[model samples]
Target: MTTALRILLLDDDPFMLELMTDMLQGMGYENVRAESDARRALAALPEFGPDLLICDLSMPDMDGIEFLRAAAEAHFDGSVVLLSGMDSGILRAAETLAMAQGLSILGACSKPVPRTDLADMLARAWQQREARARPPAHGGVK
Candidate 1:
């Protein structure tokens, strides 16, 4: 069985947060921390320090892209996944911008996150994170 991973899910809607939290739990990720307040989410980050961060595109305090920039300044070295109901094209463009800003964006998905989609994104992010964390092959001892 895959180990349960810590995940921070941020959304402005309370219902969305609850639904996603339940879905994640059902997906075998028991350590999910849900926050309906995007502003509070920023503060919770240092304490939660989740393995992955899932944030909504439109939020009250800070949009997902702005949040990414703030997170980078805070020295958060983890994968960031954006969720939005906006057009895919727009999201893609935003993702490109985030990438240009040196943000470690793992992936993005539409709102009302589906079980299958979340699972796939989580799997890919985990793999990518692991690969990045690995030391370079052929150590300097050569």
Candidate 2:
């Protein structure tokens, strides 16, 4: 079930990105991709068609807020789990902003995120993906 989900991880620090990738792999996700360059990561979204995006909220070229805006504008409907070392209040604000912009935020966590928190976020994202893929229920015409 986990391997079927395509996940894209974005962070400015190459080491952080790699660490995130390893953590994801340890959780049994196979089709995971990590990018240290936010710009390139955004460009890759169309082709990647990821089911879930675990994005860091700060970067040099394009910070996570900009990334969220661009993704929304591009009509990306996939779920997002935002990561940041910023204050909790700031992260919550970003999450709120992302939701207002029509992005599905699965969860947000401060950097050096707890393993259990990340795992829970991934689980929630999977549930969301499954929900989106489900067919709508039928009803009688009005």
Give the TM-scores of the predictions, in the order they appear.
Answer: 0.86, 0.94
The local lDDT score (0 to 100) that residue 18 gets in candidate 2 is: 85
Q: Per-residue lDDT tens digits of candidate 1, residues 1-142? A: 3344668998888898999988888778888899887677888889987778898888876888888777777777777788899889878977887777776787777887777778887887677667666887976431
Compose the digit string of candidate 2's lDDT tens values, residues 1-142: 6778899999989888888888889989989989888788888799999999999998997899999899999888889999998999999999999999999998888888889998888888889889778777674332
The global C-alpha lDDT for each of the candidates, from Candidate 1 onward, is: 0.79, 0.89
Find the candidate with the highest lDDT and give its number. 2
What's the lDDT for residue 6 in model 1? 68
The TM-score measured for candidate 2 stands at 0.94
